[model samples]
Target chain A: DQQVKQNSPSLSVQEGRISILNCDYTNSMFDYFLWYKKYPAEGPTFLISISSIKDKNEDGRFTVFLNKSAKHLSLHIVPSQPGDSAVYFCAASLDSWGKLQFGAGTQVVVTP
Target chain B: DVKVTQSSRYLVKRTGEKVFLECVQDMDHENMFWYRQDPGLGLRLIYFSYDVKMKEKGDIPEGYSVSREKKERFSLILESASTNQTSMYLCASSSVGFGTSGRNEQFFGPGTRLTVL
Candidate 1:
């Protein structure tokens, strides 16, 4: 069974628009959540993360919102640029030092 | 900067052949992980090691074995290659005090595309 899921396989947005990517999880034990962006022929790089205690965390143009009660999280990118096009993965972990459980991933396409 | 290097960018092996994939991390991290990435499966952990000579099985560990003789190097061995094992393999490393108060992010390698024919 998949503990974390990204139902949307892909998402597209125009430049300078807002792009939202959603993710859901079934495991309640997960206390930490992270988002990673991956480019073609390269590895997934760390984006932004939020602890269970926080509802939102932002980094530059990217923002991550967590809803523990709903077991859901969303990534918001404002003024999305063409360079933001890539695959996004959502991962959850019980402990900061433990292994992570990753979702299938959502491919984001930002058009110029 | 954390750097994780894999032995190869691509490899092709025949069935029943023994294949070895090597990974090296320059961050002196205590945690190392091996994962396989498929088109729709994202990334699945095959094995992980927290310390030298200590290993743990991840989500999928069948037909795979790992070795960590040194802190900087980790090896994944395929007892006998199979067609179904063809996929992209990724190596990642992170420090022990990851998360909470320390650097919990993992650094990944360029990845090795393995094809078993």
Candidate 2:
């Protein structure tokens, strides 16, 4: 069974628009979440993470929001750049376990 | 920078041949992991090591084995390679790992695409 799921397989946005990616999980035991961005022919790089205690965490251009009660999370990237186009993966883990369970991934394309 | 290096970026081998994929990390991390990536299946863990000579099997460990003789190096061995095993392999390391729960947030290598014919 897939513990994590990303319903959308792909997303396309024009330059300088908001790109939103969503993820859901079935395991209630999970309390920590992370997102990774991967380019073609390269490994997935860590993007951002949110603990279950917080509802949102924001970096410079990336923001991650979590709703523990709903078991849902979303990532928003504003003013998306061409370089932001890549496959994004959503992963989840329990607070104590170090292993990551990843979703299939969503391919983001920022067209100019 | 905590860099993880794999021995090869691409390789081809014949069926039934023994293959060795090497990985080394310079970060002095205590955790090392091997995972295989396929087109639609995403990345699946094969093996991981917490310390020297201590290894654990991940979700998919059939037909594969691993070794961690030293702190910086981990090796994956295919006793007899098969076409089904052809895919990209990734090695990762982290300084802290989840003890009973398993939490080393993984830092990965570039990856090796292995093909078996």
Candidate 3:
């Protein structure tokens, strides 16, 4: 069963605009959520994350909002740059657990 | 920087061949994992090791075996390679593994794409 799901396979947005990637999960036990960005020919890199305690976490232009009651989360990149164009994966895990359950990635393209 | 290095970038092998994919981590992390990436399946875990000589099976572990004799190295062995096993193999490591709720993020290596014909 796919516990974590990224419904959109691809997305396109203009540079200097906002890009929002959405993810949904079926398991309520997952206490931590993370977003990873991957470029071609490279492994994924960690971006931002949020815990169940908070509804939102922000770092610079990137923000992650979690709606634990809805079993959903979203990653928002404001003023998205061309460098942000890559496959974004949403992952969930229990806090302090090394094993992660990942969603199918969304390919985000930022146009100039 | 945390560097996870895979032993191979690409490999072509015939079916029935014994395959060994090696991964090395520089961060002295205690947790190492092996996963296979497919087109729509994203990343599927095959095996993970929390410490030397400790191992656990993940979602897709069939036809695969692992060895973690040393903390810095984790090896994935395909006992008999099959055509379906052809995919991008990724290795990751994390420093935190003791917590039951959550762990530190993992550092991934450039994947090794294997094709078994």
Candidate 4:
């Protein structure tokens, strides 16, 4: 069974707009949550992460909000650019060194 | 910057052939991982090693084996290639302790796309 799930397979947004991607997890033991971005033919790169102790974390134009009570997490991109078009994956881990459980991934497309 | 390199970016093999995927990390990281990314299935861990000569199976281990003779290199072996095994294989590495800002963020190599006929 998939512990992490991204119900939406794809999302499209206009440039200079806000893009939101949602993820849900079934495992409550997860303590660390992260978001990764992947381009075509390239490996995933870490974007941002939020610890279970914090409700929200932001870096530049990206922000990740975690709701532990709901077991849901969302990633938001402000002023979305065309370069932001890529696949976003949500991952959770029991600890910092433990293996990660990844969601199916959501494809984000920013149109002009 | 941490750099992970794979032996091949693309490979084609025939059925019944043995396949080997090699991964190397420039940084002196102790943990290495192998994952396969498939459409709709996302990325599934195949194997991981936290130290030299030690390995642990991930969610999927059938038809796959791993070798960690050195701290920087991790190898994945497929005894017999099958069509179902054709997919993009990824390698990642991270330090044993807390990574940047207390998160064990992994550094990934450009994936190897393996095609089995």
TM-score of each: 0.96, 0.93, 0.96, 0.98
What does candidate 4's lDDT look like per residue over B1-117, in tens digits?
Answer: 679999999999999999999999999998999999998878999999999999999999999999999899999999999999999999999887775667678889999999999
Residue-wise C-alpha lDDT for candidate 1, range A1-112, written one tens digit per residue: 7799999999989999999999999999998888989999898888988888889998899999999999999999998999999999998888655588889999999988
lDDT per residue as tens, model 2, B13-117 = 999999999999998988888989876666778998888999999889999999899999999999999999999999988767443323446788999999999
Which regions in candidate 4 have their CA more than 4 angstroms from the true location?
A: none
**How many pairs of residues collide in each model?**
0, 4, 8, 0
True-vs-predicted CA distance for residue B15, candidate 4, Å: 1.2
Q: Write the per-residue lDDT of candidate 3 for residues B1-117, one digit (tens) a residue.
A: 669999999999999999999999999999999999888778889999989999999999999999999999999999999999999999999887433323478889999999999
lDDT of model number 3? 0.91
Best candidate (score: DockQ)? 4
Reference-based lDDT, each prediction: 0.91, 0.88, 0.91, 0.94
Each candidate's iRMS in angstroms?
A: 2.0, 3.6, 2.6, 1.2
Give chain A TM for each model in order. 0.97, 0.97, 0.97, 0.98
- In candidate 2, position A51 carries an lDDT of 79
**Tens-digit per-residue lDDT, B5-33, candidate 1:** 99999999999999999999999999999
Which pairs in model 2 have colliding backbones? A97-B101, A98-B102, A98-B103, B98-B103
Model 2, residue B115: distance off in Å is 1.0
TM-score of chain B of each: 0.95, 0.93, 0.94, 0.97
Positional deviation of residue A48's Cα in model 3 after best superposition, in angstroms: 0.8
